[model samples]
Target chain A: MSTRRLIPGSAELRAEFPILAREVHKRPLIYLDNAATSQKPAPVIAKLVECYERWNANVHRGVHKLSEEATEHYEGARAKIARHIGASDPAEIVFTRGATEAINLVAQTFGRTRLAAGDEVLITALEHHSNIVPWQMICRERGAVLKVVPITDAGDLVAGAFESLLTPRTRLAAFTWVSNALGTVNPVVEMTALARARGITTLVDACQAVPHFALNVRSLDADFLVFSGHKVYGPNGSGVLHGKRALLESLPPWQGGGDMIASVTFEESTWNHVPHKFEAGTPDYPATVALATALDWLSALGWDAVAAHEHTLLAAAEEALGAIQGVRLIGTPAHRSGVLSFTLDGVHPHDLGTVLDRMGVAIRAGHHCAQPVMDRLGVPATARASFSVFNTLEDVAALAAAVRETKRLFGA
Target chain B: MNDLDDLYQEMILGHARQPRNFGALAPCDRSAKGHNPLCGDRVTVYLRMDGERVREIQFDGAGCAICTASASLMTDGVKGLARPAIERVFQDVHELATGKSDGSKDLGKLAVFSGVSAFPMRVKCATLPWHTLLAALDSTSAPVTTE
Candidate 1:
């Protein structure tokens, strides 16, 4: 196959990810499972080391120099993350374990306090289990009903469904900007606007969108937005929850611990501030700083370039894989990003995943924690190959080849 | 890293393609369902025990190649065996699939599952049928899950 230059400085950009050079099963590794989690770039890895080597101390409490420096870098990371998502104030950004925790934090604090019996929480069918289960728990506890917006057969959200679900009883509307299972990019801006106009709060799960889109919380007008660090080429245990300052201040603290307290007595303890009160315990300072480094590295590459490169790869994969007989692409949304889910006619996804592993092509093959989407598509699971900025046309070709080999092996 | 052929032997693939006893057993005396939530594999084992002697056994489910084949082979291997003999064969097959015991001990036609030991992640897929069968024999009401 001839090498195609899709992204400028493509080779250099690939070189920045050291793991891309390694071999699996004596063949070159084609890591296509970006939706599961991304491979960390060299600078992001180095930032973790730099944080541990230079400023190894707990943040925010101690008067020592190390603590002060650690606190500065930690807070600096919050500010960078805020800016990356176009938030005006750093105080609005609260660090959580990952997108799962971020959503749960909002559900426990906001959903628990604001929602009353007979109130409704609206969600789409495209949500991952993390987004679904937390609201279910909170809704069950508060006697609130959980309303689901269905999707069309093409994996797009059913047209006009969001507006219909926004009744007076609907207190919150949480949805994903991009579907991880099918790569369906929802109309988050319009949906958020619709909910906002009806005086209902909105939460956007941008875990799959942050790497591919230049998000602006101010323009999107979501009351809360969240994304995971590991999914965006950063360390695990780091994530951001950006809520409007007034909205966050209105909700009470979910968890009580050492750092979130302003003052303590035998009878009473005052909360510290907006973000800190939500943070609760000691934060993962190094991982937070490294997450900021990842954002900086991605920003230097430019979001438009990254989106273009990934789109090229996804389109190439769709064309190549779709041409093969018995290879059924799961979602045909008008707009998609990064993820491509498919299933072969005779072979199950688990068997296909095992065969692809032998060929050194890593793809996610399962329900993808979105069983409802699988049920909607009328399949038990699918083999999903998600793309990233470092992925190339060559990788798409490799995926197609591996899939063909799988079909041959299975006599399908 | 064993070759794919080691796992997907012709016999296993054949059974997976067209599973034997692959439907609900009518007027079954005992039955149990097995589920592997991680991969969404589900199997139901039905048994018609005739006074603890030779009897009929069958299974039906939706599973992967390994799981479907394993269940198919299990029904064929365990049918007509007494309670004691079925228990012994179950131990042997479990040991063979987990690599605790080599195929040197005769597992009859069940020895085809020996290849499953190499793929540690797939062991559950290979053994879901056996677990369900055991649950059916014990008449356990709760469904067996390989979590």
Candidate 2:
């Protein structure tokens, strides 16, 4: 089962990312840090340059030619995001800095407006710090409690615990579709449906999921779905926050600035509609346009091919690394995606990461901004090797060899 | 293996595996916690000073190999050094790790960190314990942070 299989277009995909061709520490770079941020493809990079070179102007308010082109591309990107996520209306997709800001927008606006004293915001232990901290901030401000659903030792969410945690006071529920640190793919569709049945608002952090698989927000029935562009082969500081039209109309605006106001007199200002109300100021138009190109690029590749390719990498890494003496893989969730974290018995993750780096293999070695998960797992940190479209079997071999070297260094 | 060996010398690994003076000191005169928030490495330096000399120096914490090894070597190196000498050692280690100066003969076992100069990122890991020792000596309660 661990035998390597060729992924069609895999070579072409690898060639598209220029960074992969370079060497680190005099060794060819074997990038296993995709969960942190994916290396951008050639088309995505070109799209960014095209947006700046061809249509560089402030969006929404200019009558000039460049402005019109910029506004056209900006709104066009929003439409592309809406279509990609299966949202019927483009007006529902709000642009933000990234997934963090998108989650913060919902927490501050929807959360602050709807939640009251004694209310609870339910989250999962698998959530990234972005998903966890925003709810904590909003809950604290609204005099609401923040509750967490527990996960098993295998990093799977405890299904029974989730139902018990959901109460009449659970005003909202937010969770990651795919855990960044642990590779656990949460039961997002079922969890969203459960929350919907109880009339609790739901938000899904698809930062990790969007890169590995195709997503349709409508089928998931989440009130809000967010993912960063950088994670999905797009430019940095660009993301989509897909909210239900009715829910967005109900919530108050997050930021007050030029583009978000319909009319501003000296005293009172009328807020703009849904997306514009949330997206204040002149946005990063180049990044927005480049994000659309990234979606198109992935759509061209198709999910079947992408998913199959990533699975092979994950499976091979699991088999190769598990065979190493004294190496303990962190999570074996029944369903997982994108990441593989592990600990070597005698070598600290930092040492492993440093050694791996010397061998031209890059991996994350820390809590991965999810301290709660670390606290639960009883480890300070784990060395993580995350897969992406560009990763191949050679990369996995390099990773396995590096782990063996690390073990040898520690005399295991 | 050229520069990497320098950073993780056999001596450094030995010190990390069996850190010297690794435990809390009871009724310690001066103690300060050190934190490297980026990697969640924490160390608490305890000093029992005898007038101008460090009578006892010990550390208790969890950290990466570089940090643990540095702390172990630091405690073992500075146990009998006076304040002025400890200050000089700190400067020498700093210079050695940053490649600003050659390994002074005085650095001794601590010279094992001279390879750390090649890996700029790990310099903090080797110096955090030393700074925490300074904080303890200064009698400050604020945790020393190596950002």
State each model's CA lDDT, in order. Answer: 0.91, 0.89
Q: Over the stretch A260-333, how does candidate 1's per-residue lDDT look in tens digits?
A: 99999999999988899998878999999999998888877767888777888888999999999999999999
Stretches of model 2 off by over 4 angstroms after superposition: A1-9, B51-53, B80-85, B102-105, B139-142
TM-score of each: 0.96, 0.96
DockQ per candidate = 0.67, 0.74
Task: Write model 2 residue lDDT over B24-127, tens digit each, in one string.
Answer: 99889899999887677889999898986799989999899899999999998888787788888989989999998844466678878889999987888889
Model 2 chain A worst lDDT window (10 residues) = A1-10
Top lDDT hit? 1
Residue pair clashes in candidate 2: none
The best candidate by TM-score is: 1
Q: Candidate 1, after superposition: displacement of residue A222 in Å?
A: 0.5
lDDT of 2 by residue, A1-412 (tens): 1124324337856777888889898889998998999898888899898988899999998899999999999999999989988899999999999999999999988888899999999999998999999898988899999999998999999868877888999999998999999999988899999999999999999999998888898899999999999999899999999999999999889989989999999999999987899889999989989999888877777689999988998999999999998999998899989999999998889889999999999999989989899889989889999998888898899899999998887786
